[model samples]
Target: MLTNRNILLCVGGGIASYKAAALASKLVQAGANVQVAMTKNAQQFVGKTTFAALTRKPVYDDVFIEHDASKIAHIDLADEADLIVVAPATANLIAKLANGIADDFITTTILAATCPVVVAPAMNVNMLEHPATVRNMERLMADGVQLIAPGVGNLACGWIGKGRLPEPEELVETLSGLFQAKKLENRHVLISAGPTIERIDPVRYLTNDSSGKMGIALAEAARDAGALVTLVHGPIRGTLPSGITTIDVESGDEMLEMMLTHYDQQDLVIMAAAVADYRPTVTYDRKQKKIDGPLRIELEETTDILRTLGERKTTQVLVGFAAETENLEHHAQQKLIRKQADFIVANDVSRADIGFSSDENQVTVYGKDETVTPYAQQSKTTLAQNLIKQFAEALR
Candidate 1:
């Protein structure tokens, strides 16, 4: 699938640098045009000759060296690259790239490259835990760089922890996904997001902490995969992406009505919104003033949109989400069965660092067949991309 794609592999100085050689070989054997570049310190562990012999191209390490004599090597390499990958990315290399300190050929070429860049961090556990390294990784990710996060295991330094480069086999799959085919082409996707507000009075309402980022991310991903998306969202503080249909709603009933109206036309339905379970039995025309020491408000169950859709659905894949504080997988499995959903995206809202308002999430996807897929903490955008890809596969 990666045939004819020009991939530049940048190897930083680390014990994990050896694994990069295998990655380059894998890409080359998979029909990718791989070019190897190494740092000065990287050459200490893996000789420049070794990479040249493997890639059948000169290994680049210096910005001063001119490979073509006319074109600057760094610029030429950067211009030809369709994608650049940094395997065994040491803390220094990460910091340098994040701070724009391009003093070496590897860094300089990366600075000149306009293509997508993916980083696989490899360092000591302590170094990875350092605040500086953490900030650098976050900054890189924020700058639109993809991260193939490190794996957890025994390290060469005798301390077992994260910071180990993911095996070359896994890296290959992640890179392939960068250019995966758009399996969702021509498909219509319907998505619901954010927390639905059930009005009590003009001044107050009942809602959850959902910020709607997950649903929005999925909508964008679906659009990117060539699917037409309609986003039914609640009142939330975020901008909508262009090229997709967007509907605003306040209550669960409103969202349900809109969804059902458009349901038959969709190929996939993702119920991601944190819809209110109950709404006030009675709503006053005006804000109620504090007249008594205690006020009683009766509640009524709102519409069960997922269950309703499951019953009404035909020739469409139904997906639901479960946001729980405990027994996530158990709850997700039950929901998957109860709602007759094909899959349920379940997450523990208990983690303060992720879910709801956070930019990242960790979730386990439960399928009706009892199959489960777990995804670790990552940006919602990344997670959505993966989910959309998998969803497309499920359709096949």
Candidate 2:
């Protein structure tokens, strides 16, 4: 898939630098012209000779190399590449790129490049969570750089957290996805995600166990397809996918308002949020004191956002989700018909491993023609990709 692509691989100073050598070989095997640039400190972990052997090219590491005015290798190398990849991007290098510090050849070429840049960060858990590093990462994202998130596992620093670099094959797959012409280019997608909170008192609320993993996966998949995606998210702790515009909200009412404001602008709308069906009529401003007796509360129905949007939708594709414990297909079909949604994704939430907070899900999609497609248990990310692919085909 990456045939004839020019890839400049930047290896930074980290314990994960050894992975870069394997990554270079993988890229080369995939028919990419690979060039390696290494930081001086990186040599301690992985030798420059290994990279040279893998890529069959001279490893660039100096700013004052063979010092001739016409032989400015950094600029030349930067201009010749189609994509720049930084594996094991240490906190120092990320800060340097974010702050435009070009004291080294790698940073200098990064500054000089005009193509897309992808970074895989690897460091101590504490360093990854540091405020400065987080800020720098956000800055890089705003600048259109793509980050392949670090895997969570045992780190060299004796910490167990998310600081491990993704495997070499995964990095190569990410690069391939980035360079492939996006299938959903110029499409506008609006997605609602997470479980909405319904307040009963200042400290008490009604919510679900939804972790937003499915919705987040869908957002990431849509973004990868080159769609202009706006994610209306409820209270969830998952990371927002790179390149998506996120609007965070706490309650179902707020989510509804955001969706109403943006839905008209989209060609597709997916209502994946698990909104509260009922809420306390009177929400106390302060925490209510619990008595040693049963408490009685007046409940009212919340706004049906999908129904409202379905009523207003004209040519836009509208999709809804149903999490049911009984009569799943019957209820989902009724929801699809009643809400006027084009399709309903229904799943049995009673299965502890298949729904709500789980990383994997199994769902059945009901279409207007009563056609049901069953999706077996799989990672939410993979399921999202499948859903988007089907949606894109329907759009076409």
Candidate 3:
């Protein structure tokens, strides 16, 4: 997907600098032409030679050096880049970027670049939470910089908390998605994801294990494909992509309502959310305190969102997700027919590594003509792009 794409990798001064080397290599393996730029402090962690060996291009760290005037190296690099990525973006670097301080080569190129900029921050938990750093991050976001938040884990500073950089594989997947062809350009896509919460009381509610990662990924993928995407998301812990419009909902009925209102505007509809099959028949406005006797609650079925969309679908392609643990194919095929969906993506939630809150998934796509396409286990982001590719081809 990254074929012929140019990625300017700006390495910042931080202990996570070594991860940048792996990031560069991963980008190359994924068919991107990578150019490495580093801060002077970054060299203390990873050598310039390593970046050169991996990218097969001279590492740029000095701004005083002169290149051809007509083809100024920094400006030329910025002009030609499809995307600029800053991995291990230290506090200082993030601040400089947020404030437009171009005292160095990395910041200079960033200031001169016209492409999308993505920054993955890595620092100690204290630094990450510092008011100055937080303010700077907010400024960058306001200025249209995409941030991949640091993961939470053990840090090099011996403190166990947030500020760990995302793994190289995940970063590679994100970058690849950013530069993919805009197959869904000029199209509108509506996607629903995550589990809806039905409030039993102010203090209690019913929901599921759905993390909404897959649905969010689809929204992002569709947006990257140049589609105007709207994600109707239930209560989810994961962050939404930067540019897509999001509508938050709390119950299956609410989701259905939102979908019905916006469904007519979409060229494609994807029902990936794990809406509650059953909701409390009666929801109490106030908290229900602990009762001495056993408590019982009546359950009622929620609206059939997918079936409704399938019935209303005309030229728009409707996709549904079926997560089954047993008789996966049979169940999925039945749902595909019953829901009148154009395609149904089925996965086994029995596996611990994929599906339902997991980072990876392997799915089988069942088309209306009984055709099945299987995909290997991959990150939700990658899976989303693959699905969008298939959808785009079907449209063509």
Score each candidate by Cα lDDT: 0.88, 0.87, 0.88
CA lDDT for candidate 3: 0.88
For model 2, what is the C-alpha lDDT against the true structure?
A: 0.87
RMSD of 2: 4.5
Residue lDDT tens for model 2, 172-277: 8667866766778989999999999999888899888887878887888889898999999999873477788999998889999999999888988999999989
Off by over 4 Å in 1: 186-267, 271-305, 308-316, 321-334, 345-387, 394-396
lDDT of 1 by residue, 241-273 (tens): 667899999999999999999999999999999
Clashing pairs in 2: none
**Candidate 2: Cα lDDT at 41:** 91
Model 3, residue 1: what's the lDDT?
A: 76
For model 2 the local lDDT of residue 175 reads: 79
lDDT: worst 10-residue window of model 3: 64-73
> How good is model 3 by TM-score?
0.79
Candidate achieving the largest TM-score: 3
